[model samples]
Target: MVTATALEAELLELAGAVPDPELPVLTLRELGVLRAVHVQGTDTVDVDLTPTYTGCPAIEAMSLDIERVLRSHGMREVTVRTVLAPAWSTDDITPEGRRKLREFGIAPPRVRDGSDPVPLSLGPTRTIATHAAADPDPVHCPHCGSADTELLSRFSSTACKALRRCLACREPFDHFKEL
Candidate 1:
């Protein structure tokens, strides 16, 4: 692992502070996409960024934002490289980010053990039950805090989120899907 110099760390923070284009509520750092920043020369720097998923549409905007932020911070040249290896996962999201998402009326992705296989509910939405015993970690409604929620659609406003409806409050919300 490479240790970051004080200057590099400061630049990283500036880059990380850039708000995500798709999710304005969360910064790139909170979203866990801003990987690292390396100073290449006196005024040039290179940054590593990972997308939430492969071919994420917001990547270009994210790169541009990072470059703009760095340039304004006195960086003569800034390059944002998207790295695919060590894929980005929902688990990478920080606790603060999750809380912000929930406060923003979006259900945050649940934490999971990477080694374990995810439990799959294969039955029809209406027939399936969301019992506590059945689903230990049910996607609770961000609005009413109810576990009684059903998936309305696999895709929502963005590819990363899914549309879900809370049976209790009769409200629709987006749930950030576990990557």
Candidate 2:
């Protein structure tokens, strides 16, 4: 495995600290977007970032924020590159990020494993344990912690999320869809 120099590490931390434009509650690091930071020369650095998904409009904002941060921290030239290889996954979200998402009234995407059963959300309280790799896990309401929720819309405020209403709490919220 490659190791980062102290300066690179520091720069990485700074770049990762920038907040996501869409989900302001989580940092880029927490969202697992800031991939790496490499110091090219004395005053130049290159940063690799993966968006939450392809064609994410927020990538430009994230890049600007990262560049501004690194430039202010003594780097003369900062290059933020969008990396598509090893596409970003919901599984990349840190545990803390998931917690923050829940706290912010968004249902975090359920973690997935290849061995796990196919999750199919039949309804707010219905489930079908089939062999299909669908989202079978119930999107619990973050406010009331109730599994009784209904999808109001396939897309929420963002394309990456779904709008849901909790039957128990009668509150509407967004669910970060699994990617």
Best candidate per TM-score, number?
1
User: lDDT, candidate 2, residue 47?
Assistant: 96
Query: lDDT value for candidate 2?
Result: 0.88
Residue pairs with backbone atoms closer than 3 Å in model 1 (clashes): none
lDDT per residue for candidate 1 within 135-171, as digits (tens), equals 7789999998999888887789999998898888989
Clashing pairs in 2: 119-135, 119-136, 120-136
Query: What lDDT, from 0 to 1, does candidate 1 have?
Result: 0.90
Q: After superposition, how far is residue 9 of candidate 2 from its true place, in Å?
A: 0.7
lDDT of 2 by residue, 44-151 (tens): 999999988899999999999999999999999999999998888888899999999999999999888863443445454322322223436678899988887777
Candidate 2 worst ten-residue window by lDDT: 124-133
True lDDT of residue 101, candidate 1:
99
| Shift in Å, residue 130, candidate 2 | 15
